[model samples]
Each structure stands twice: as structure tokens, then as C-alpha cells.
Target: FGLTRDIYETDYYRRGGRSFLPIRWMAPESLRDGRFDTLSDVWSFGVLLWEIATLAEQPYQGYGNEEVVHYVRYGNITLERPPNCPEILHKLMRACWTFSPGDRISFRSIVDELVPYENEDFRLNAYYHTQPHSQQETVLTDSNSDEKDLLLVDDNASEQQ
Candidate 1:
């Protein structure tokens, strides 16, 4: 695969030492109990989507690390959907952020949901139909809006093999 993540581990906390954690991208449960499980990865992926949607803007822009933990873990706050993000991706991100781990969408299901969007038809539906191959980029433009979006993908996807 062009860029794949391999995940295989259980949640843990060392008994008598300090540990580094990704504070902003953590799930509520992870922040609460130091439990970083697969479901936590889903939550982090949602934040990653938010980062991409914001063109790398930091999540909870006005909040400090402790504030993020308090708001997300106790206040049940989540980042609002970016104004320019496509509905489909935003829906996926929301699913990934479900508070209950059991309710969070699985990675396999995320792949299944996104698989259909790989086709030209879905791009058209999303108003991202242009397919200029030179830079390996697909551009999304809306006639009524000034914003433009770019998506880069490999011509030879590993899934094709």
C-alpha cells in the first residue's frame, strides 16, 4: 500500500513513570483513563480529518491542552464541521467521534464506506470531477462557491493488485 498504518496493541499505562501522549488527538476515554485502544484510533482519525479540512489548522484552536481534555472529556465537545468540507467526509468524521467505543465506527467499515468514493461517479456527485493526471491531483470546485479543493491519489492503487 502507498501509505498504510499497521495497528496491533492494547491499552497500557506504566506503573511508575511519566509517559508521552498525543493530547489534542486523544479520545475522551483515553484522556480519562489512559486507555488508548483501537476505538481511540478512530477518534484520532476524525481529528486528522478535521486537520485536513482546516488545511492543517490546530484542533480546538482556542483551547489549551488541559482545556481540550476537559471540554472533550467532560463537556462532550467536538470540533464543528469545516464550512468547506464535503458532507460525506464530515459524516464519517462524526461517526469516528462517537463517545462510546462500541458505538465508534470500525476501521474496516470506514474503508468500506470510502471505497465507493474512489469512482468517478462519486467525485461528480461531490463536485470534484476534474481529473488532471499530470500532478496526480483531483480538484473539486463548486460553481456557486469560491473555494477549491485538491485530492492527490496514486494512479496505481495497491487495491488494484
Candidate 2:
């Protein structure tokens, strides 16, 4: 996740000139720098909007990662959502890919905007954990200290869950 220009220059991009970034899933700030926030990730997800609509065809096809880097640096390759894409989605994608990081929309806003499509069961599936409490406790306590403490506590707990 901590992608940097130095790494990009030395690694994948040098081999094929295009790194197959799957930019749809990558945070844009990753294309620029590592100090990005969630908004940058949302921007990547917005790009995913187009990819999903097109069944994962490359974003900005005909360019590799290096070419994309150059084009992005020069402000040349503005992404256009596929012609058949919906206007609401197109606008959403635009907000996600804005050059200025501050201008990108928040994930909360995106979810709010998409709320109309959600069903009652959809809300419940996410809001409530289905596993019984006893099962959860059993799983949490079953791991040995070595396995449980392999990494930092904060992240490990989440991983175990």
C-alpha cells in the first residue's frame, strides 16, 4: 500500500513501461506519494466504478503504468466513464479523480449518495455479526499467544476477527 515513486521507478514499471496498476483499486495518492488519506482511496474506487461497469478492462487503455504516470503528471489523460455509463456515476467518478486531493469526495458522502440502492437485508448483513457470541469467544481465545501476538496488538485483533 505504501507505493512510492522510487519503488515504482526501480521495480515493475521499468520492466514493461506500464505496471498494470489496476488503478481502479489503487489509491491515486499512491500514484503520486504515500502520504494520502482515505479520499485518495475513494478516488481509486471511483475509477473502479468504470472498471466494474466494463468488467475490468484497463482504466485508460492503450497506456501502461509509465505512460500513465507521464500522462497524469502532464494532466493529459482525463478519464471518461464509458459512454453507456450513468450520469450520476460519471459525476461520482469525476469527484473521485479530481487532481486536487482536497476536492475528492468522502466515502461517507459516497455511501449516502448510494443509499437508495440498499435493501433492508443489506443493512442487516453489515450491521449485525451472524456468528454466535460463544463461537466468537471460542475463536478469539483459541489462538496461542505466539500466533495471537505475531504482530502489533491493534492490527492483530482485527485480523483474528
Candidate 3:
């Protein structure tokens, strides 16, 4: 049997409700209502990114599930950028956590963003290149203009997907 089947057959699965799951992984809308879809998965992906970036640190470490749910629903609290997380990756995670489902970035865009990091050699060189003050300044200056264009492009691409 597949992993899903094995997990589903467990006693924990037989016990209904989300008591066993972490509230940090749940999207705000999913908590408020029963609605779940790709957008919800996107939110979960953002939480997963946080976990990976923090070396699997439990999210909202000191908060209870109810407290987290309230904070997420009313205060819009999201995972803070981990100490060593790449700015681009953190940006992608933020995009995934957009409050409105329609505004959240698509998984395809997430894959696109991660494609460059997949090549270890390129990543090393790129990391070094990006570290220069001049390069950082250039990126900051260009990002605002690029963001407008990217939003339009991402909207079109997400619609097609």
C-alpha cells in the first residue's frame, strides 16, 4: 500500500478532527471554514518552507493551536524569516501566504523560483555574485519595476495553470 493508505489506516486517522495536526500548517480560511483547495496547499507549502529553513523548528513554538488560529485569522501573523533563509526564498514563502487565495503565488511559480538553486555549482557562484554591495543595490533598484511586471505575468501564468 502507498504511504497515504498506510497513514489513513492508522488509529490516529480514525480519530476525526485536526487535534493531531499543527495549526501552523493550516491556512486561515481552512481554519475559519472547511474550505480547502490549491490555495490551502500553497499556504501549507509556505509553512513547510519555514520548517525547512529553520531546520524543522516547530512553528509558533510557544503558542497553542487556538492562539495560533486567532493570531492567523485576526492579526495575520506569518512565519518570520529564518536566520539563514535566502531573501528570494523568503519572498516566495510570503507570496504563498497571501491572505486572499487569488493573490497567492502558484506552485508552478514556486518551482520556477527554485529552479536556479537546483544546480549546486550555479548556486554557489550566484550566491557569491549576489553578495557584492553593488549587486545588492542594483537588485533593490530594479526590483520595484520588476515586481509590477512580474505580478502581471504571474497572474496570467497562474490563470493558465
Candidate whose lDDT is highest = 1
Q: How well is each residue in 17-127 modelled by candidate 1, as lDDT tens digits?
A: 666456778888888888988899999999999999999877887766667777888746899999889999999999999988899999999989998869776766654
RMSD to native, candidate 1? 15.6
For residues 1-161, write the lDDT of model 2, one tens digit per residue: 66644543322343347544444344546666645578778877887888887776667777676777766655567676687888888888887777777777889989788788778788668634454543342223436575564332343456667
Candidate 1 versus the native: TM-score?
Answer: 0.62
Least well predicted 10-residue stretch by lDDT in candidate 1: 6-15
Per candidate, the number of residue pairs that clash is 0, 1, 0
Candidate 1: stretches off by over 4 Å: 1-17, 120-161
After superposition, candidate 3 runs with Cα above 4 Å error: 1-21, 120-161
Q: After superposition, how far is residue 105 of candidate 3 from its true place, in Å?
A: 0.5
C-alpha RMSD of candidate 2: 8.9
* Candidate number with the higher TM-score (1 or 3): 1
Candidate models: Cα lDDT each: 0.77, 0.65, 0.73
Better of 1 and 2 by lDDT: 1
- List TM-score per model, in order: 0.62, 0.60, 0.61
Question: Looking at model 2, which ten-residue stretch has the lowest summed lDDT?
Answer: 7-16
* Structure candidate 3, residue pairs in collision: none
